[model samples]
Target: MGTRLLFLVTAALANGVALAQTDVPAQLRVEETRASQLMPILHHLTDIYGPRLTGSPQLRQAQEWAAQQMRSWGLKNVELQPWEFGRPGWHNRLTEISVTAPFQAPVLARALPWTPSTNGLIVADAVILMPPGMPAAGRAPRRTADSIQAAKGGVAEPPMPKMNASPPLPTRAELLAYLESQKEKVRGAIVLVGPPAAPEPDFIPQPMRRTDAEWMALINAPPGIAPGSSTRPTVEDGRLTRDEINATIAEFLVKNGALARVKDGGERRGLIRVESTNGYGATPQVPGVTIANSDYGRIARVLQGGTRVEVRMNVQNELHPDGSTAYNVVADLPGTDKSDEIVMIGAHIDGWATASGAADDAVGAAVMMEAMRLLKTSGLKPRRTIRIALWGGEEQGVYGSQAYVARHFGSFEHPKPGFAKLSGYINLDHGTGRPRAATYFGPQSGAAIVAQKMASFRDWGFMGANTASFRPVSDSAAFYLAGLPSIGLYQDPFDYLSRLHHTNFDTYEEVYEPDVRIAAVEVAALAFALANDDKMLPRFDANDIPSRDPAAGPRARIRPPENHGEP
Candidate 1:
């Protein structure tokens, strides 16, 4: 908070008028270590059922398991509501890749999510060339039109582009970066990869944050970074063509998967998290991590520079048709006097096929579950019905919530009920950080007193309401699009993100009990207060309309076609 606001807050506290601190009872203790009955429930969802990839058999099993668990929890009307989605499923079984020839050390690699695995140890000669320019596998000659044109100019015939070019594994980090840099067009080599590592906000920034062994190695330079391990100080020599980089990564994935190559220790390691793992492409067959120039030189000398290297790898996986039988786990805490009105809290249950969906949403789901579980267990029934929705197919889009809104708020496209008797919506989807209040979509004045109370969670030192403003991104966006005011709560993404997030590293070990407990209290307290409060969160009264016409509109405007072969 700014100085003036702090002063105002201080002044308000001194007055003792008790303005907006209505969300929690003065006696509620929101400290870390507060245990919930639902903790074990969340564990089973994450540990037993594992990753609930949308549409997969195991995913379906998980969905059913979630519903059953909720039913066991005594939730009413618990059922798996079916919806259509992409068919089939796939899961990895075997991933083995090794480099043969000049030198060899185990390498770090992974397979793209949803990629067809090679049945056995496939072998191929390594080739390191850029995209749309490298020739197909095993084709000795560059006879393309461009090659001919270049040859006439004595332009040392450029390496032919890959005709048998297979899809590459793209990372979430790269995709987000590309989108940030350009929006006019988003294309490159096709990728079947998974979410990349979201950088850890703190440890990653600390240069000396490495272990004693790592520090010694960095300082000595005698014993270079351990095999398949990376060292500090990454640098890019010159501006590299984005297309070139994309091709390089793509080729790396193909060759690595086919046992053509293994990446040197020039790349960084992956992070693991509790309750979740970004397993999208966490295998020894995919590509994203690249070797450092110094080390890559060794492999380049043999592969790109002509010496042939032999590598072998095997990828085994199962395939399932894409089908979407959507389901949202919903429960109710009926209100005494205002049972008709509703207060809703939610977090998505579906996760990236790669992750365990823990932090990305498990924490959020757990938070939502624990909030209601705490209220009910504590014998604190709400004054208005409190609804909890663990939505399905959220990763595919807000299909679950959208379907709810479209049906519950009939004429949603035309606006009949504006909201679903929704006093407000509170959502959590960020990784398992501590409770840091929330970000809303309104002027400070609108939530003035509430913001003050929200900040009170800060008293615990781990929880504080930032009162920052953020547009909708998760399921809340569906509500926001329907003109309902929503609040997105978050914790410090310091470790939860970089450490676990969506990688295979996302495991139960990564969750900080103190942090998760802190979050649970804050979220429950917020829900309880909101349920008992008199006023509803402010809504967007100005120009609230469906973003686009269902029939057709500017949103569906035409775009120029891609010039396939043109540079």
Candidate 2:
């Protein structure tokens, strides 16, 4: 009887221990049924607030709305963290481009942000204006009619072009002189540039997800530098920089009373990509617009055929001179035991002005908000405080997160009070797709812990984790540079690169509901696990952190297309 009673007690203790181990995560998962709550937040951000350009009014309003939402959920320290932005805010009010003379046709176009308005409507004759071209070398060898006939008769022919021929590039002086000669032609005329060749249809299909083999290859690949990681401006032999040359051209056009500059939309399939002036604080002296490729091509063809083509351009843009203050939405869910330590999750709230900026980042912000809500409602108290940061000015150069990190955690040379207290930071900015795996910026040990914590989420598309020093050029880099452990969740490709990134097509319709909800649950589970872990994730030694090269100029700004290549 005593032996039987001991066995029963042992089995009961085993079952109790198992339940204790699984209860929190299981409860967290149960709370995730409320993950659908993310859609309303996303809708309010993308649909109601529109594009949240850095330093713009819409972004400020969105920041306030997000803060209110967090506070209502009983979060602590919910506030908009302020940062200084020297530039005035800019947004497009109206843009109309049309062919008036040759045929009545409306042109699809989007105004470049920070460009001046056309006052009202300006209708003028269109002129093709291309930047001066470099001089070419010797011409290709010609194929005579006799050679053509010989080839038809099965005779061998000589190679067409002379591969040995080469030519020196034109000097800056020559190029400027050629541009000076076109001043009269562009005076009072609408200038059209680019489309060196007409766009063709794309037949290749875009892959939705990276295969397990591809993911493993990426995980095990050697440390590679991300594009635009260097912050230096490119200057050719100390000559004029590209921005300087463009500024010279723009000033020249303004001097000649050019109506407005127009260019191809830079992508096929009628998608418009709009960009701002190179200098963040400076506004363009002359108005500019990027029109659909088809419209641009038709107008160029008519002018090439010696027929006079007239176009009408009407643009209205608002510049808020006082909109110099940028804010980041920050809030905290207090912990019980290790409340001094912090675990962070963040996403950028700013985007380009071309579209609603839904897929580029709004989905990320919504998922983070939902994850925090899930942790709070599940009644699972973490040991370390879990914080949510919605950053601004990411589209330009990740200014918001950089400023936050600098204020809270000092640089590699110096350490701040809060530096030692940070457990880790996870940033999501890849796209709207579900996270497939995570990449760590610290060490392999940290990644191992993350893999173990996230193992239960395998069915949700999270395969595993790996150690990688270089992270995608997102908000996480700021923390990584400060010697803190940072993790970036790599997501499936979906249509982010092909259709939604920084284009007019980045709207709510592109976001998939299931992907985002599952992503929230995964992030919540990981955060809960990490917060309650016995010890914090290890940080990189100061020596392990990469120091900036003094010779490189201020970190180069991130242009979405150039910087967001696959890891």
Candidate 3:
């Protein structure tokens, strides 16, 4: 009887090992297939649906399509959760700009979203307003009848006159002075404003996946040293306060009867960087447009040479009422044992209207959807429920995620019953880069737990995990502020900052198939591990708050100097 029992025990152990070996490769293959097959999903979200500005009809369509897709994939509890977004809805139907005087040429430009539209086609003389401290170029010499007669006599014409160098933009006081002195010149003309003061370089190095040693140090470091200790210098003081200076400029231009305000495009290679209209909650004082730098430079040269420059522009935009409700798409895959516990993953679904927001978030959304599909279809029934939330108003201020947390899990100031059941929240909104590591924003006690949970996937190129104070930039900010275990996936830069982020070039082609596929596999594996973990992830003590306001809601109270909520 003892020999028979030993044989059965050994056979059971062998079968368990075999199952474990088979599970990894099988799940990996499923994710691989998902990665390669993501093009159709990408096309549908970006190409077919087009730009999904929050609260717009297109975004509503996208939310419906995403919810339907989730349901079709067998995800349960699929619904479009509504939230109050305190902003007016806006859409741009038509925009056109061209140079009509001194030379006829097309000028590439895009109207700022949500700004007031030109009543109709406006043809006005262009005026280049140079800043203070720089001298304006002298007028070019004109050819007289005597000069033409002399040139006809075969004598060399007078040497061409030299043009003075372009001037730097004016300071606040100088700008005020220019506006006062040239008020009439700027009035009734399309004024081209110079770029603002150059900002200081961002010296902070981009974060990569944490190494094992780094993770160990994070677990051992004292409070205020590891997280929330960044002493990065800010350029906020150097910036012209938008409401004070920029708004004054806009008001002054409008009061002076300016037809439209055109600014030089900051982007290189003809890329038009578009943004929302100025002055939230109110229509802009004047219509605004961003002209390509090359064309703008040409106009500036002509104006400096004392030549009249004219431009023709037409912009058609509409603003809906402010009370329109935005929605977040939510779906779930039920768990088995600890069904009440939850592991959540999300990406923002809304994007700017200038381009298909493929790289900014569509890639992350696709990965989340595909990961859920792989786990569900692969027959992996986790011990805890897995929830997927495609957020709205993230681009605005992470309103969708904040509203979700406040409604379901309660805000930091007010804890609810659902808060305790949450195991962890994972977010991937950076872009379509490959996932290399993760940053954990929970209590120090949870570091070891995360490390152990992530160890199995080290072979898949996970750099391990490190504890860091969360920056309230992405949707993870809301979860972190509430002291829940939250994480942001670290990824390769992949031109997300330099080129594609929020630009017209952010289209479907920016997706790198192999890298995105790897990211999908990593995200799916992480979600599965978190869901199946035995214990709930630890949270920071209520008093141990990060360097941010817990009650600030979606708009992160602490914004970086470079991004002062311009959009």
Q: How well does each candidate superpose onto the true structure, as a TM-score?
A: 0.64, 0.86, 0.79
List the candidate numbers ranked by TM-score, top first.
2, 3, 1
lDDT of 3 at 341: 92
Worst 10 residues of 3 by lDDT: 133-142
Clashes found in each candidate (C-alpha, N, C closer than 3 A): 42, 2, 1
Candidate 3 residue lDDT tens string, 355-418:
8889878888888887787777666788899999999987776788989998899845678999
Give lDDT tens digits, candidate 1, residues 412-512. Answer: 34665535477777888766666544555443443454455465565544232322222345677667556565677645554443345455556566566
* TM-score, prediction 2: 0.86
For all candidates in order, the CA lDDT equals 0.51, 0.76, 0.71
- For TM-score, the strongest prediction is 2
Please identify model 1 stretches exceeding 4 Å from their true place: 1-35, 100-104, 132-267, 270-302, 353-355, 410-413, 416-420, 442-446, 449-456, 462-468, 497-499, 543-567
lDDT of 2 at 96: 86
Please give, for residues 4-102, the per-residue lDDT of candidate 2 as tens digits: 643554454446533254545554554555335888999998999879888888998889999999999889999999887778888888998889888
TM-score of 3: 0.79
Model 1 earns a TM-score of 0.64
